[model samples]
Target: MRGNHVIAEAAIRAGCRFYFGYPITPQNEIPEYMSERLSKIEGGVFIQAESEIASIHMVIGASMAGGRVMTSSSGPGISLKQEGISFLSALELPAVIVNMSRGGPGLGNIAPSQSDYFQATRGGGHGDYRTIVLAPNSCQEAGDLTYKSFDLADKYRIPVLILGDGMLGQMMEPVELPPEIPVKRLPPKEWTITGAKGRPSRFIRSLILDPFEEEEHNWKLMRKYEKISKEELLWETFSIEDAKMIVVAFGTAARIAKGAIKRVREEGLKVGLFRPISLWPFPTKILKEISRKVKHLFVFEMNMGQMVEDVKLAVDGGAEIHFYGRPGGIIPTPLEISRIISSYYYQKKLG
Candidate 1:
């Protein structure tokens, strides 16, 4: 299955009933698949909105009505939806957002890129809130993460981001599709804006007019985020035990780094790979533990050193960190990365 289509299909099986998005490269297949597939589902709905901004707001509406909702786009389109994302955060609504990012600053090409790392992890919109960020490197992880994202969003009442790049979005891979979940089996959302007819009067709004009330609301959101950072963390490690050097990466870059590590291992070098599946709530504590054992850490990314910052914070001076990056949409091969890894390992005399 193509990665983008897998996200759409996985979402359907996960009980996502509403999808809102505009056409954008790399991820256009998500909406295209959703539009055709959703039309046939029992309660499914798909809308190709007039703009990305409009689509995100539409997501807010569906989520407000207690539906499993999603929206997808590449870098530029995602940028246009930032304000609504902040709105979703303030409203404390549950929704899934897919970013099959492409090269960018403005109107960057449709080719694969990971330049949105900072944007996705840092709560791109205007707010002091954060959305859970999940980075999936392959089609399988992409599908699996999308299926899981809905649950995470509802569990925390926060938006969940499935971060990917054009390569993952466009490639084909054999993925074991998730089983279709019955929508009726899903739990009810008590906060939905259903009619207040029979019960006591109630309303939902993000406008916390008074400054003191807003401050409390902000702290409440921070408390929720703290809870997430504590409980919701995911990462993968390969050949990490007894390693002299570790390479930290996520998403597609991690896959490449893994291959490079394998190659270096065959040459009798003790190099390992660390992949952070949850970009936010980053693998700080565990990574710090690894740094105590391994004195050298390296970070690789398609973009110019965005995730490296997190790696540094995790190591916190316990390990010496090195970085190699290919910015501006240049995809490096495993051989190229392996050479760099070998060179760095020997230079540090860790052989």
Candidate 2:
């Protein structure tokens, strides 16, 4: 199945009953698939919202009504949804958002690019809230992570983000569907403001004017983030124990890094790859431990050194960190990454 379709199917299996999205390149297949499948379900709703803002709000409203909801978009659409996302977080809503990112500071092309790293991982919306951002490198993970994103959002009572690039959304690869996992529905809509019955009405607002109240709310959200950092920092490591150099990457770049690692290994160079599955709760501790054993680190991304800053912070100047990648819609190839590894080895030998 196509990667986007895998995500759409996984959303259905995960009990997402509502999907609202605007058509965008490299990820339009998700909405297209949902439009077909959602109609078959008894109470499912799929809407091609007039705009990204409406799409995000529609999903958030559905989530507040105790329905599993989702939305997908690219870079520009994501920017438009930021306001609604911030509001959803402020209300502690549970929904999954997928950003099959393209290039840009603004209106970049529909080619695969990880340039949205900072925006996705570091709270693109206003205020001091964080989204649980998962970065999947393969089509299989694209499906699996979409399912997991719903659970994470519910677990933390916050929006979760599945961050991928065009390659992950557009590529086709074999994916094994998980066994029939039971869909966990939200608790009886007691907390939701559906309507005032015999009980008191509920309000879902993020406004707390008092500094003390706002501080309290912020601290509660922070505690959730701290727990997530401890429990959900996921990553995959390959050939790094005795490696002379390590490649730090995520999403599509990580896939290319794997090929580059293989090529350098065949050439008798001790290189390895580290791919982060969770971009928000980055695997900083693991990278720090690996840094102690490696002399050099190379960070390959689809953007200009966004994640490299985190890598450098993790290593804390213990190892040399070098970054190489293309900006905008350009993607770095395996051969180019291999050459970078070879150049690092040459420089080390000369030194």
- Per TM-score, the best of the predicted structures is 1
- Candidate 2, superposed: residue stretches over 4 Å from native: 180-190, 196-198
For candidate 1, list the clashing residue pairs, or say none: none
What are the per-residue Cα lDDT tens digits for candidate 2 across 1-351? 889999999988888889999999989999999999989987889999999999999988898888889999999999999999899888999889999999887888999999999888887889999888999999899889998887788788889999998989999999996553444543444566678889887788899999999999999999998999999898999998778888899999999999988998898888889998998898889899988888688899999789998898888998898888788888778898888888887788722
TM-score to true structure, per model = 0.99, 0.96
lDDT of 1 by residue, 111-207 (tens): 7788999999997899798999999999998999999999999999999999999999999999999999999999888888878878886676888
**Backbone clashes under 3 angstroms, per model:** 0, 0
Clashing residue pairs, candidate 2? none
Error of 2 at 21 (Å): 0.5
